[model samples]
Target: MKSYRIIKSPTEGFYKEKGSKFLGFAYHVNSLEDVKNKIELLKKEYYDARHHCYAHLINDGNQKLIRANDDGEPNHSAGDPILGQIRSFDLTNTLVVVVRYFGGTKLGVSGLIHAYKTAAEDALSKAEIEVIQIKQSFVVEYGYEKTNDVLRIINDFGVEINNQEFLAACTLFGRIEPEKYEALKDKLNLVHVKVSKT
Candidate 1:
């Protein structure tokens, strides 16, 4: 299994050019909803800012989802530059937003790009990078008679149990590398454990 890098926590960065101020925020996001919520909060906090541009990259199954928004800035000026910083850092499941407070100055396209890029770069540079394995979650259910056998198979296959119930019918919520899932499923099926990906 391959590992990917992401920020451990949210971070902020700043840049000022030609009297205009740029505030940057970087976050480790899990889904599209997370990105939208963060942007909404920032918009409310920086209500008077002239623009709120953003970019995000998400790992969804075998595909990488990416989006960038200029928020009325000249096309490709703000958003793409911010996304470029994300790409340079080789990070996934991350979102970067840059808010601009225009200070009666019109930063030409080049200037805007530099400002956004620098702000995003600063934010990412301040983040604590973390590496994580790609994992898939699954649920396993089995009768009490096969509880030990099912649990042993999961344990031997390196599945991390996140939750469990020890009732008459056993249930376990676990996560493991996707590559090992098929093998694990086969082993569990032998003992009549019902397994399904979550």
Candidate 2:
């Protein structure tokens, strides 16, 4: 995907039904490490919780990795509904975890699903959602004579230049959206400039 929505920061909300309480957390995550770290932190924070159901969507350049765990709840009752909320928002690179306090009442499967769904929805509703473009990094090398052409390409493609050098041969380090990276790489190749992924 060229772009996707994600929460701007960590957020949380709560729901209660039949004396059972669900505490939902939403966090912006970009890697498996982030997912693991957040889960670990929550587990320590809610050590007495009966369950810690969670769902995560991580986009790593070429593909999306998803994880949903019921954490002892009935199959598809907790995790799946939380994941459904993420999907309903068309979001990626996010994680939602629901920590349950038994409250001495066992919610049936349907009730559990509704509680988890509402908890996730409430957390997301409090989040600041923003659309972000997928980016790719590249290093471009060209002769000094082609400086203007290289600058033109950067300007035209909206490439973000991170570093550059001016010498007999010039080097530019930059990043751009994937689509623009492909098109700019092709055009730069025609000018005898070298472009490689970073």
lDDT of 2 by residue, 70-140 (tens): 99999999999999999998889999999999988788999999999999999999999999876899999
For every model shown, the clashing-pair count is 0, 0
lDDT of each: 0.94, 0.93
lDDT by residue (tens digit), candidate 1, 1-198: 378999999999999998899999999998999999999999999999999999999996668889999999999999999999998999999999999999898999999999999999999999999999878899998888888798779879988899999889888999999889999999888887899999
Give per-model CA RMSD.
2.8, 1.8
Q: After superposition, how far is residue 135 of candidate 2 from its true place, in Å?
A: 3.1
Q: How accurate is candidate 2 locally (lDDT)?
A: 0.93
Residue pairs with clashing backbones, model 1:
none
